[model samples]
Target: MIRTIDVHKSFNEQEVLKGVTTEFFPGKTNLIIGRSGAGKTVLLKILVGLVTPTTGDIFYGDVNFSQLNKKEMRAIRMKVGMLFQGSALFDSMSVEENIRFPLDMFTSMTWKEKAMQVDSCLERVSLGQVHKKYPSEISGGMQKRVGIARAIVLNPEYLFCDEPNSGLDPKTAIVIDELIRDITIDKNITTVINTHDMNSVMEIGDNIVLIHEGKLAWRGDKSQVLESTNDTLQQFIFASPFLQRLRAAALERSQEG
Candidate 1:
């Protein structure tokens, strides 16, 4: 599990995160969601140790992550996995090579051992035969799966995903969502996702925190979203006419029952 205590960040003189505190539970999808420039991205960066918070503490289990030295941070990072927004696969590398990159860097495992681990992760992501293909040769959804396979190659205890469904069609997005959710539960990893996708919020958001203007405005699970009357959450969630109508219908049904 990951916990943040009064996390605050600033750039020069402009503050991005304002005393944000939250906890991301294990074996569930913990989502950081908000509008553009709402500081959610900065918070994610801080959580991943890419950026330092001006005044706050980040905890990975009982260890103070923000106070760790380079060597200590490296040790912790070995057990952490990240799925980038763009899939971030090397164009020149085949899927197998990409998945095996971490093992090659972090372990003394033999080539055969690495290959077996890579194949296992690929099969877990349901992309068994794409090992020889380059990133350019696969569909966008396939590329995302490849990224996921790479992220889990180390069997990480903490998984951080930044916009996992960024560019896929609605159907493909749902598939990716379910895949991530299933993996999180199966591995009992502490999964943190930074996303603005409403479908993702309503579908896989086991724990959702809404950041608005640099602070956490609300927190709840998917089941509580529609029934929530918080103005910030309502405004952000029901922004689209379609979603507003859907919420209306849901409320009407609830009233009848």
Candidate 2:
């Protein structure tokens, strides 16, 4: 699990995150949702140690990540896996090579061991046959799957995905969301995903954090989200006509049944 306590981040005079406090539980898909510039990305970066919060503490499991030394942080980072917004696969490398890159950089595993790891991850993501293909040769969704396979190759205890469903069709996006959620439960990984995708929220939001104007507006599960009375959350979520209708219908069906 990951927890942030009164976190604050700023750029020059502009504060991006304002005293944000939240806990992301393990074995679940923890979503951070907000509009652009709402500090969702900044929070994700701070959680992953890519950016330092100006004032606040972050805890990974029981350890206070904000207080860790550089070497200690590096060790924690090795336990982390990140799937970038764009899939971020190397254009030149084959899928196998891309998935094996982490082991090559971080482990002393032999070629055979690395290959075995790569094969396992690819199979897990259902991309085993595309191992020899380059990123350009596959569709966007396949590339995202390869990215996910690579992220999990090390079997990280903490997984972070930034806008993971970006650039994919709605159908493919839902598939990726379910895949991430399933892997999180199966591996019991502390998974954190940054996205504004309401579809993802309704589908796989085991834990949801709603950020508004750099502050944490609400936190709860999917069921609680629909029942939440927070004005900001309601406005943000029900702003879409489709989601509004869906929520209304769900409420009505529940009442009638």
Candidate 3:
């Protein structure tokens, strides 16, 4: 599990995160949700060591991640996998090469060994026989799967996904969501996802954190979302007229029963 202790971040003179503390659990999909510029992105960056927190601590399985030296940080990073918002596959590289890139960069595995590992990851993502295909040759959804394949090739202990369902049809997005969720449980990885997708919240959100104005506004699972009376959560979640109506209907039905 990963835990943040009263973390705060400042950009020059402006503060972004303010004493935010939370825990991301293993074998579960932990989602960070907030409006744009609500500091969610900054929090994720801080958690992954991309940004330095101005105050407080980040702990990775009892290790003080915030205080780690460069070498120690690298060791922790090796066990962490990140799936970027755009899939971030190399356009010129084949699917196999893309998946094998991390192995080549980090490990002393032989070419044959790398190939086998790549193949295994591809199979795990339910993609078959696309080893030689370039990113442009496949659909957006396939590229996302390739990203997932690459992310897990190292069998990381922690996984981070940024907008995993972005830029895909609703159906394809759901497929990606389930794939991430399943992989997290199967590998028992501490999974943290930075997303704005409400579908993802209700579907795979085992732990949910809502940020508002640089502070943790609410915390709960998918089951509690609809019933939550927290004004901050309710305002952020039911911002749309359709969703407001849906929530009202859901609440009314629950009252009737």
lDDT of 3 by residue, 1-257 (tens): 99999999989999999899999999999999999999998999888998989999999999999999989999999999999898999998999999999999999999999989998999999999999999999999999999999999999999999889889999999999999999999999999999989899999999999999999999999999998999999898889999999989998999999
Using TM-score as the measure, which candidate wins? 1
Q: What is the C-alpha local distance difference test score of each model?
A: 0.94, 0.93, 0.94
| Residue pair clashes in candidate 2 | none
Off by over 4 Å in 3: none
Candidates 1 and 2 compared: the better one by lDDT is: 1
CA lDDT for candidate 1: 0.94
Q: Candidate 3: global Cα-lDDT? A: 0.94
Q: What is the lDDT of candidate 2?
A: 0.93
Q: Order the candidates by TM-score, highest first.
A: 1, 3, 2
Candidate 2 local Cα displacement, residue 113, angstroms: 1.6
Candidate 2 TM-score to native: 0.96
TM-scores for the candidates: 0.98, 0.96, 0.97
Q: Cα lDDT for residue 133, model 3?
A: 97
